[model samples]
Target chain A: MAEHDALTRERILEAAEDVLRRFGPQKANVVDVARALGVSHGSVYRHFASKADLREAVVRRWLEGVSAPLKAIVAEEGPAPQRLKRWLDALVTTKRSKRVSPDKELFAAYRALFDESGIAIETHVGELARQAAAIIEDGIARGEFRPVDPDETARALLDATTRFHNPAHAEEWSDPGIDASYEAVWRLVVAGLTV
Target chain B: MAEHDALTRERILEAAEDVLRRFGPQKANVVDVARALGVSHGSVYRHFASKADLREAVVRRWLEGVSAPLKAIVAEEGPAPQRLKRWLDALVTTKRSKRVSPDKELFAAYRALFDESGIAIETHVGELARQAAAIIEDGIARGEFRPVDPDETARALLDATTRFHNPAHAEEWSDPGIDASYEAVWRLVVAGLTV
Candidate 1:
C-alpha cells in the first residue's frame, strides 16, 4: 500500500509537469493536472495539499534535476580547481540549454514557476552552494586553494558567474561572443581562487 | 523659437515622469502626461514620436543619472584599482538606493520601463562598459595590472558583480551579509586583475 501510494504521487507529479508545460504556471491548475492523470482533483490533493504546494513540488523536482549532476561532480575525486571548473561549466551549459532549448514553451513555463516559487529557489541555491563549498573544502585540505572560508568563497564563486547562469541574463546568453566572455571571466575567477 | 521648443520638450518629459510615478508604466499614457502639463496630447506628440519613445527617454534619463557619477569617477586621476573600486561602489550604492528607497511606487514604475526599454538598457550598459575599459586600459599602461584585453576584462568585471547591481537580485541586496559578499567578490576580482 505504501509503494502504491508513492507511485501514485509520482504519477501525479508527472501529470502536473505535463499540465504546466501545456498551460504555463498562470493557467495550469490542480484540475488540469488531475485531468491529465485521469484521477480526481481530490486524489491529486491527497498527494499535494494545494495547488501552490503541488507547483512548488514540481519546481523542486525540476531544480533537483539541475543540482543532482553537480552533486556528483562535487563528490568526484580530483584536483579542486579542475572539479570547480567542470562544475561551473556544467552549470552554465545546463542553464543555457534551459534558456535556448527546442522545447522553449516548456522551459518558459518552468521559468515562470521558478520565478514565483521562492522557497524552492532558495533551497536549490543553498544546495548548490553547499556542493561548491564541499569542493572548496577539499581544495583547502589539499593546499590547492587559498585558505578562505569555503562557504563564503563558494557563494562568491557562484555570484561571480551570475551572468552566465542567471535567468535574468538569459537573453544575453545567446550573443555570439558570450562563450568567449564567459571564458575570460572563468580565467579571472581561477586566478582569484589560486593566486 | 528653438529654445522654446526645447523647453516644451523638457516640460513634457517631466510631466511624463510624474504620470509614470502615479499611474505606473502600465496605466500611464501620453494623455495623462498632457493632462499633468495642462497641454494637449498633440503637444506631447510633437516632442516625442510615440508613447514608447517618451518612455524610453525617461528610462534613458534615469540610467544616465546612474552612469554619470561613475563617469566622473572614471575621469578622476587616481590609481586604476582604486578608481575601479570606487566606480563599482558608486554603482552598488545607486542601484541599492533605487531598490530600497521610500519611493517604491516610482521605482517600480521605472523598473517596468527599464525592463521593456531594450535600446536604452543596451546603450547604458555599453557606455558603462566603455568607462570600465578605460580604467582597465590605464591600469595596464601604468604597469599596475596585467595586459589583458581591457574591453573584455571590463565586461568580465561587470558580469562578475551582476548580483550586487542587477535589478533581478534586488531582494537579496537587503541582506546584512551582502556588503561582505560584495567585498569578497571585489577582492577576488582585484586579485584576478593584479595577479
Candidate 2:
C-alpha cells in the first residue's frame, strides 16, 4: 500500500508538470491536473493537501534535480579551486539552458509558482550555499583558500554570481559576451579566494 | 516661445508622474495625466509621442536623478579605491532608500514602466558602467589597482554587486546582516583590484 501511494504521488506530479506546461501557472489548477490524470480533484487532494502544497512539491522536485549534480561535484575528491570553478560553470550552464527554448516555457510556468513557493526556494538556496561552504571549508583546510569564514564566503560567492544564475537576469544570459563577462568575474572571485 | 514649450513639457511630466503614482502603471494613462494637468490628452501627446514614450521619458528622468550623484562621485579628486568604495556604498544606499516607504510606492509604479523602457534602462546601465570604468582607469594610472581592462572590470564589479542594487533583490536588502555581506564582497573586490 505504501509503494502504491508513492507511485500515485509520482504520477500526480508528472500530470501536474504537463498541465502546468500546457496552461501555465495562471490558468493551471488542481482540477486540470486531476483531469489530466483521469482522477477527481478529491483524489489529488488526498495525495497533496492543497493546490499550493502540490505546486510546492513540484518546485521542490525540480530544485532537487538542479542540486543533485552540484552535490556530486562537492563530494568528489579534487583540488577545491578546480571543483569550485567547475561547480560555478556548471551552475551557469544549467541556468542558461533552462532560460532557452524547449525548457523556457516550462521554466516560465514554474517561475510563477516559484514566486509563491518561498519555503521551497529558501531551502534550495540554503542547500546550495551549504554545498559551496563545504567546498570553501575543504579549500581552507588544504591551504588553497584564504582563512575567511566558509559560510560567509560561500554566501558572498553566490551573491556575487547572482547575475549569472538569477532568473531576473535570464534575458541577458544570451548576450554574446556573457561568457567572457562571467569569466572576468570568475577571475576576480578566484583572486579573492586564493591565499 | 521655446522656453514656454519647455515649461509645458516639464509640467506634463510632473502631471504624468502624479497620475502614475496615484493609479499605478496599469490604470494610469495620458488621459489621466491630462486630467491632472487640466489639459487635453492631445496636449500631452504634443510633448510626448505616445504613452510608451511618456513612460520612457519619466523613467529616464528618474534614472538621471539616480546617476547624477554618482557622476559627482566619479568626478571627485580622491584616491581611486576610496572613491570606488564610496560610490558603491552610495549606490546601495540609494537603491535601498527607493525600496523603502514614501518612494517605495512611486518606485513600484515606475518599475512596471521600467520593464517596458529597455532603451532607457540600457542607457542608464551603460552610463553607470562608464562612470565605474573611469574610476578603475584612474586607479590603474595611480598604481592603486592592477592593470585590468577598465570597462570589463567595471562591468564585472557591477554584476558581482548586483544583489545590493538591483530591484529584483530589494527584499534581501533589508536583512540585518546585509551590510556585513556587502562588506565581505567588497573586501574580495578590493583584493581583486589592488595590485
Candidate 3:
C-alpha cells in the first residue's frame, strides 16, 4: 500500500510537470493534473495538502533535476579543466530545457522561496559556484588554468553560461554552435592566466 | 512658431518616457500624461496621433541615443584595435545606464513593429552587432584581432555586453567591480582571438 501511494505521487508529479510545460504554471491546476493522470482529484489531495503544496513539489523536483548533473560532475575525479567543460555542457543543457516561461505563477513560487528564511536562490547557486571555483582554484594551483581570482573567474564563467542559456538569447545559439562558442570561452580562460 | 512646436513635441515625448518608466506601459495613458503635465489630453493629441506614435518616437530616441557614440567611434579613422576597444567601452557604458524595463509600454510598440514585419529581437540587436563587427573585421585585415569569423566574434562581444547590462543580473556586478570584470572579458576576447 505504501509503494502504491508512492507510485501515485510520482505519477502526479510527472503530470504536474506536463501541465506546466503545456499550459504554463498559472493554468496548471489540480484538476488538470489529475485529468492528465486519469485519477480522481481526491487522489492528488491525498498526496498533497493543496495546489500550492503540489506546485512546490513540482518546483523542488525541477530544481533537483537541474542540479543533479552538477553534483555528479563534481563528484567525478578528473582534471579541473575537463570537469569545468562537463559542468558547462550540463548547465547549458539544463537551462535550455528547464522551465521556458516566466509566468506569473512561476514568478510567485520564486518569490515565495526567496521570502522564506530557509530557502534562497543565491545560497543555492552560490554553493554550486563555490564548488566550481574550488576546482578552478585547484587547476590554477596545478598550472592547468591561468592564475586569477577563482571567485571572479567562476562568476564570469557562470555569467557567460547564464546569458548563453537564457531563452531570450538561446535562439542566438544552436547546440553545436554553443559547444564551439564555449571553446572560445575556454581559450579565453586559459589565455588570461595560464603559464 | 515652428521652433515652439518642436519644443512641445519634445516635451511630450520626454513626458511619455517618464510615465512609462514610472507606471509601466498600462498606466502610461494619454489622460495620465495630461494630468501629470497639466495639459489637456486633447492638447497631447495635437502633437501626436496616438499612444502608438508617441511610443515609436520614444524607442527611436532611445536607439539613436544608445547607438550615437558607437557611430562616432566607427566614423573616426584610427587603428582597428584602438577603435574596437573604444567602441566596446562606449557600448557597455551606454547599455548599463540605459535599460528598458519590461514594464514600459514600449514592449507592445516593439511587438507591433514585429507583427508588421518579421524582424526579430536578435536581428534588431544584430544590426548594431554588424556595425561593431566591421571594426573587428577591419582589425583582422590589419592583423590586430585574430583571423576568425567576424560575425561570430561580433555576436560574442555583444553577448558579453548584453549580459553585463541586463537588469535582472545587475546584482551579479557592482559598479566599481564591473570595469575589472569587463577587463577580464577583454582579456578573454583578446586571448581567444587577438593575433
Clash counts for all predictions: 0, 0, 2
Cα DockQ of the candidate 3 complex: 0.26
What's the i-RMS of each model?
1.1, 1.1, 3.3
Residue A4's C-alpha lDDT in candidate 1?
37
- Pitting candidate 1 against candidate 2, the one with the higher TM-score is 2
Q: Any residue pairs clashing in model 3, and if so which?
A: A146-A193, A146-A194
> Could you give the CAPRI-style class of model 3?
acceptable
What TM-score would candidate 2 get against the native?
A: 0.88
lDDT of 1 by residue, A108-130 (tens): 88888887888889899899999
Of the two candidates 1 and 2, the one with more favorable lDDT, higher being better, is 2
Q: Please identify model 3 stretches exceeding 4 Å from their true place.
A: A1-65, A74-83, A100-119, A134-144, A165-195, B1-12, B18-24, B27-50, B76-82, B99-124, B170-180
lDDT of candidate 1 vs native? 0.84
| Top candidate, metric TM-score | 2
Provide candidate 3's TM-score on chain A: 0.69
> Chain B TM-score of all predictions, in order?
0.93, 0.94, 0.71
Query: Sorted on DockQ, highest at the top, how do the candidates line up?
Result: 2, 1, 3
Which pairs of residues collide in candidate 1? none
lDDT of 3 by residue, B135-192 (tens): 8888888887767778777777666555675444544455567777677667656655
User: What is the TM-score (0 to 1) of chain A in model 2?
Assistant: 0.94
